[model samples]
Target: MIIGICGSPRKQATEYVLEQALATLREKGYETTLWSVHGKWVDYCTHCDYCLTNKECVVQDDLQELYALLTGAQGIIFASPVYNGGVSAQTKAVMDRMRAVVAADKNFFKGKVGMGIVTGGDRNGGQEFALMQIHTFFIINGMIPVGGGFFGANLGATFWSKDTLDGVKLDEEGFRSLKKTTKRFAEYIERYGVKDGGKQS
Candidate 1:
């Protein structure tokens, strides 16, 4: 199954692109699901080492469900809006909490394929840096990270704030290209892909 972990609120391009990615995955006979962590007050980690052994978080919040999604999916498509050259706080918190997954199983994220999409406010903006933040997590977690024929495909070069904030319009044209990249990535991972330094369960 292919799962999308979206950390954006409202119906932004993340939702649209993620939906399209899932649709394409479905067309390819792959089951898919979407999980959004929008508007939720997910707190940051407290520098605790609880997850390194408990296989879960000490705090009770959205992370409980997120941990299951992370471990159960065959592939993960993660998306977030670039905020000051990085992922949003909510997204970071969720990713940060992944320590629990690591603590539960040393190789918990092994062999899981990951794709990160970041929306930028302007052209050639912090796209790469923003993606790096998420891709770094995948790298350290032993997940295979895929990009647009490179290492991190741009969801688009830029985003129109007016259209984005309104949620009435999305980068459909950009998503069309991104859809191709995402589809090809999904297939590659499914057919002949494995997580870096990890194994498939």
Candidate 2:
């Protein structure tokens, strides 16, 4: 299944964009699920190393369920809203908490495909930097990172929401970029398949 993770604390523009991307995946006949972190309690890693021997997070939060979803997903889309020129604290917390799974298995994300989507208040509101941070996480975790292409989404799908849902709806180029990225992600999954539960399926 394809998993779209919305890292936005608010359920507005960021959620809308992620839903649109998931809709495109569904249109292409891919099984998809949307995981929203709006109210999820994903705590940051304390580097306690408890997971190193236990193979699970000691914090015992919502991330336990998220880890299962992540492990089972063939493709993943991480979407976040720009906050002070970077990803929101909620998004960063999710990424940081992923260390529990990573500690369990060094290549936990191996062969999985990942894409990024970012929403900004302005046309050039640090979208690229946010994408880079997400892409870096995917790479360090051993997942393949996919970009939108050579055009509007050379990094990833970026939306200028102008800090509002209605403004996001008005960004035609942003919508197009998201659609194109979704298409590419689906195609890649179909052609190459994914590794689930540490095995390629």
Candidate 3:
């Protein structure tokens, strides 16, 4: 199945972006699911070694469920709203926690296709840096990171709150550009998705 992952702290906008990405994937005739990683208080990794023996993390928190979702996804849409010059602490924590999974299964995420999306507060916000942060995680996990066909997939950082995300939009143009990027991402999946490539690396 194709899964969209939202790693943002703002639940509303992240959900909206994730919904659109999932719809794009569904329109391309793929089964889709979305998971938001900001629902609970997820802690950072503590360098604990329990994962080596238990096949699980030492920190008992939300990411345990996220780990399950990761294994089930064939394609992933990873979205984050930029904080400062990169992904938020929430998203980074999830990425750091995932190191345990990489350890448990060295090739756990092999062949997975991943795309990046980010919303910034201003035009010159650190959109590209945030996208690189997400892509770096995907690459370290052995996943292929994808960008848009028409243009790159960096969503102009958003200043619109949940209340203004839809109706009278302030960042609509940027979001529209991001939509094109996400659509291209969906098309890329349709073009080169590997669903039956055997077990993950």
Candidate 4:
């Protein structure tokens, strides 16, 4: 399944863009799931090393459920609103808590396709930087990161939400980028299949 994760605290522009991407994947005949971090209690990683022994997070929260969904997903699209030149706190928290999965298996996300989307309040509001940070996490986890082809989305989909959901709709370039990125991600998943426990199936 293709999983689209929106890390914005509000169910506005960020979630809307992520939904568009997920819709594109679904239109391509891929089963997709949309997950929002809004109202979800995903705590920051405590660095307690408890996962090293138990292969699970010690903090009791929604991350446990997310872990299962992430592990079973073949494609992951991570969307976040740019905050102070980087990913939002919620997004970072989710990324940090991924350590639990890493502790369980170093290559838990290996061979899965990952794509990033970032919404900014301004045209130059650090969208690229946020996208880079998200892509970096995927790379570090051994996941394959894909982007829209040449001309646009050199990293991934980027939207200038201008602090409003409707503003994102006006950014036609952003919509195109999201569509292309999602298309590429779906194509990759179909071509390579999904890797589970180091085996592609």
lDDT of 3 by residue, 21-126 (tens): 6786677787887778755768988878788887788887877777877776778777777678788887788888887887788777787778877766556567
Candidate 1's residue-wise lDDT over 28-54, tens digit each? 887788888875557789878877666
Instruction: Provide C-alpha RMSD values for all models, in order.
Output: 3.4, 1.5, 3.0, 1.6
> Which candidate tops lDDT?
4
- The segments of candidate 4 whose C-alpha lies over 4 angstroms from its true place after superposition are 193-201
Clashing pairs in 1: 111-195, 148-153
Tens digit of lDDT per residue, candidate 4, span 58-171? 998987888878877888889999999999999999999999988998878888889999999999999999999999998898888998887887888999988999999899
User: Which lDDT values do the candidates have, in the order given?
Assistant: 0.69, 0.86, 0.69, 0.87
Worst 10 residues of 1 by lDDT: 154-163
Task: Score residue 154 of candidate 4 by CA lDDT.
Answer: 83
TM-score of each prediction = 0.84, 0.95, 0.84, 0.95
lDDT of 2 by residue, 1-201 (tens): 888889998899999999998888888877888898888887888888898999889998887888888787888889999988888888888999888888887877877888999999989989989999999998998777888788777888999998999999999999888877877777767666474534552
Q: TM-score of the candidate numbered 1?
A: 0.84
TM-score (C-alpha, index-matched) for candidate 4: 0.95
**Residue pairs with backbone atoms closer than 3 Å in model 2 (clashes):** none
Q: After superposition, how far is residue 164 of candidate 3 from its true place, in Å?
A: 5.2
Task: Determine which window of 10 residues in candidate 4 has minimal summed lDDT.
Answer: 192-201
What are the clash counts of all predictions, listed in order?
Answer: 2, 0, 4, 0
Candidate 3: C-alpha RMSD to true structure equals 3.0
